[model samples]
Target: MLLSVFSCNSEPSIQDQMVDNPGDDGQNENPDEGEELSYKEKAFATYEMIQQLYKKGDLYKENFPEQNGDREYSYLWPYVGMLTAGNVLYELGYDREILDKQFTGLEEYYDNRDYLPTYQAYPVSGGATDHYYDDSAIVAMELINAYELTNESFYLERAKTVTDFIMSGEDSRMGGGLYWFEGQSDNCTNGPNCMKAANTSAYAAYVTSKMYQLTNNEAYLTFAKRVYEWTYTTLRDPSDNLYWNDINIGSEQINTTKWTYNAAMMIMSAVNLYEISDDQEYLDEAVTTARSAHSKFTKVTNGRIFYPPNDSWFNVELLTAYIQLSQYDSKTKDYVEVFKDNMDYAWENARNNEGQFYEDWSGNNEGRFYWLLHQAALVEAFGRIAIYENQ
Candidate 1:
C-alpha cells in the first residue's frame, strides 16, 4: 500500500533553514502565475476526471474490461483516494451536488455490521471486512476534515469511533508505538502479527493531535506525545534527521528506508504539538525536518523540483505538512515554488490521455498502470497548492 522512500544514506551538513517571510523586492511570490490553466482550474479538471472511477457512487478496485474484469480489488486504498480526492473537491469550492457524490462514496466505506469500520469493503455493498490501523487512521483524520467541511455530527462520531479502533491497535510494544495492522496481514511471516511501522504510528500521532484539538481531550494529547516521542526516538535517522520505515519489536529489526510521509506526518504532528503547547522546540523540530527532508527527497530538473514517482500517495502528507509549516515557518515558504513547479510539470508531462496522472511524475515509468490513489494524491497536492495561493 505504501513504499519506503529511497535516499542516499550519507548525510550532508544540514542548516537551520527556519524562515521569516521575506518582503518583496522584484523576487516576489507565486510560481504558477499567468499559466494557461490556473492551479485551481487544473485541480478542478483532475477532480472531475477522477469521479469517473466511482461505480454507482463508490470506487472499487479498477476492473478494466480486459485486465481484472469486473472483479473489484476491494482494497482499502480506493477509500483513501475518495477521502483525499473528496477533500480536494471541497477545498476547490466545487458544487455541493458534486461533493455529495463523493461524500456518499466515502460513506459507502463504513462497515455497519458491527458499527466498526474495516479496511476493505465491496463497492456498493460496503460489506466484507479487514482492519488496518493505518488505513482507519487515514480515514479517521479525514472524517474530522469532513466534519469540518459539513459541520455534521455523524462525521465527528465516526472519527471518534475510528480513533478508538486505532487505539485498540496499540500496546506498550517496542518502547511504545502503535502496531501497523489490526491482525494478521498479508506478506508477513507470522499470521496476525503486528509490525510497528513508522508511518502508521506517526500518522496516528498526527491524527490524535487533531482529535485533541477537536475534543480538548488531554488523553489524546498524552497519547500523541507517547506515540510521537516513541517514533522520534525509535525510527529517526540521527545521521540526517529523516525517519526509518518500520521496526520489528520482537526481533528488534529496523527498516532503514527513509520515507517522506513518515517524516511529513511527524512534522505535522510536531507543528500541532507546538501550536497547542506553545513550545518552540516542536516548531524548531518541524522546521528542521521540513528543510532537511525537502533537500534529501527532491532533485532539480531544468532548475525545477521533481519528487519521486513510485508512491506519490505518500507525498500528500508532505505537501499538506509543507502548507501547514509554511504558515508558521517563513523558511518553508520558499519551497512553495518547488511544490507548484512539480504540479505544473505533472500536468504538462505526466498526465494520461484519460486525465489520470501516473504515480511516477517523472514519466520514465509512464507504462505503469493508472491508479486512483495517484490521481487522488495529486488532487490533494494541487488542493494544497490552491490553499497556499489563496493564502
Candidate 2:
C-alpha cells in the first residue's frame, strides 16, 4: 500500500545531524567563488543543500534553519517541488537509490481515509490537513512522469488513486470545473461561496489527458476535454490571453489576479490535448498562450532575461510548460533559455551563506530565512534546464 512507506524519526534535531565538508559558516561549499557552474552541477549543489537543510530521514521538513523543535514535514504543496525535482534528477540519470528514496519519502504524505485515497496537504503525523484538489493533481502528474520514466505500476496506481479523488471534485456548478477544495458547502451555488480555480481545473485536465496518453483510456480524455474547455472558457482573459486566478462561484465574479502557474497549467492542458487528440487547434492554442505568458511574466534584467519575481515555484511551472512546448514551437526555445539565464544568475547572486536560495531571483533583496519550496523549485528548474540543454 502507498501508506506503508517510511517510519518517522524520533524528534529531529539540527544539532544532532552531521554534514560532510562544511564551510566555515557551516554550509555546503559553492563552486569555488566566481567560477560558473554547469546547469547539472548547480542542480546537484542545490539538491545537496536541500538534503542538508530540509531533510529529516527520507522525508523533508517544511523549512531550513529549523524554526521549531516540532520538525514539521513539508505540506503537500511544497513537497510537489521535491517530487518534481526527483523526477528531473531521474531524467538526468541519477542513481535509482536516490529516486526510490524520494518516492519512499512521498509515501509519508499519502492519506487513505475514505474511498479514494489521496495525499493530504500535511502529513498525518502533524494532524489532519485539508486535501486540496490542485495539490493532489500536481503530485499525480509527477507520479505519471515517474511511471513514464520507470514503467512502475506502483507509480501509476498511486497516480490513478489521487486523480480519482481529483475528479470527484468536478461538478456542473461553474459549468463543469473542479472546485478548489475537496468538499463543497451546502449552498456553493449561491452567495459568495467556494471557488472553482484555474489551477485545480486546468491541472485536472492536464493530469487526465496525460493519463489518457499513458493508458489509452477514452474516459480520461473525455474528462480532460470537459475540464479544459470549462477552465479555458471560464477563467481566461480575452484581453491578454492570460488566465485569471479563479471564479467565485456564488458571486460569479472572476478573480483577476494573474498567476504564472495558472496560465502555465492551461498551456500544459492545451499541449496535452494536442498530443492526445492530434488536433492542430490545440497546438495553436498552446503556442499562442506560451507567447503571451513569456511576454506577460518575463522581463529583461541587466543583459539576460529574468523570470517573474517572487513565487519562484510558479515560474518553475512555467518553465516546465515551455520545455514541453518547445518540441512543437521552436520559439519556446528562446523562452526556455531565458529561464536558464535567470536560474544561473540566481545561483550566482541570490544564494545565502548556506547556499539556500532566497525567494527573490533578482538578488536585490536579502531574505533572513529561506523556504524549502523555493530551494526545491530552483533544484527542479536547474535539472530541467540541464535536460533541455542536453536535448
Candidate 3:
C-alpha cells in the first residue's frame, strides 16, 4: 500500500518568490551567432533559459511580461509543461540536481482538499484554486514517466495519488466519462453545459493505462479500457478520424473544433490499449489516428515542415504520441523527422532576443511576451528527438 506525501500549508516566503532575472534585456539576437549546438545541447539551453527567466523560486511566471503583477506564479498547466520537459531531458542523462529541483516544485500546487488530495490549477499560496481533471492527469503522466526512467518509488506513489484524484472526476454522467472540472455541482445536473473534455478523459485513460503497465493492477486496466472507450465513442469525429474538443453531456452537442493534443491522446491511449490487450483493432485505430493527425495538424512552410502557430505544448503532446506509435508504423518516423526539421528552423528563425520561442514557429511573427509553456515545449521536442536519434 502506497501513501501520498503530506501536503504543505505554510506560506512561501516573499523573498523566495521574488527572484527575477537580473541580466535579461529582452531583445532579439542573431540566430547565426550561436555555435552549432546539438539537439540535446539546444534542449539544455532552452531549459536553462526557462529557469533563468521564469523561475520565481521553484514555480514559474505565466508569461514573460506577466499579465498580472500580483498573481505572478504560473498555473498548473504551464508548470506541468515545464516538468514534462524536465522529465524528458532527465531520461537523456541531464543534470540530476536541476531535474530534481524543478520536479520538486510541484509541491507548491499540491492540495489536500478535505482528504481528496490532488493538484489545483493555481499554487496553494493563493488559496484553493480550481482543480481541473486534465491538469492532474497530465501531472500524473509526467510523474509516471519520471518513475519509469529513475525507478523511484516516490514518483510512482505520487502518480498513484494523482490517479486517485483523476478517478474521482469520473461519474455516471455522459454515459460514463470524467468531468473536466472538479467540485462543480452542475457537473452532472447542468444539461448542455457540463463539459467532459477529450483532453481530460482521454488523458486520464492514458495515465490509467500507464499505471496498469507499471503495477499490473487489473483494476487500473479495467478503468483504462472503459474510459478509453467512453472518450472514443463520445469525442471522436468520424469524418476526420480525429477527436473533437469536447462534448456537452446535457445537450449532447459536440464541439467540432479540432486540437492537436485531443487526437494525440486518443492515439496514445489506443496504443497503450493495444499493447496491453494485444488487440489488433486498437493498434489499427492508433495507426489511423496517427496518419490523420499528422496530415491535419502539420504543413509545409517555406520547404520546412511546421506545426500550427502557437500551442507549442499541444504539438509536443502530439509529437510524443507519434513517437510512441512509430514502433509499429514506420510512417510515424517520417512525421517526427519533419517536426525535427521545423525545430531546427525555429532555432534559426523563430527565437526572440532572450532565446525564448515565439508563439509562431514559422519565424514570421515575433512578439514581446514569450509564454513559459512555449519555451518548455521546445526543450521537450528537442530532448525527445535527441533521445529518439540515440535509440
lDDT against the true structure, each candidate:
0.67, 0.76, 0.77
lDDT of 3: 0.77
Q: What local lDDT does model 1 show for residue 271?
A: 95
Please give the ranking of all candidate structures by TM-score, highest first, separated by commas: 3, 2, 1
C-alpha TM-scores of all predictions: 0.84, 0.88, 0.89
lDDT of 3 by residue, 201-286 (tens): 88988999999999999989999899999988878888878987767766777777788888889889999999998999999999
Candidate 1, 168-213: lDDT as tens digits: 6667656778766644332344322335777778888988999999
The local distance difference test score of model 2 is 0.76
Model 1 ranges off by over 4 Å: 1-35, 53-57, 60-70, 113-127, 185-193, 367-369
Model 2 clash pairs are none
lDDT of 3 at 349: 75
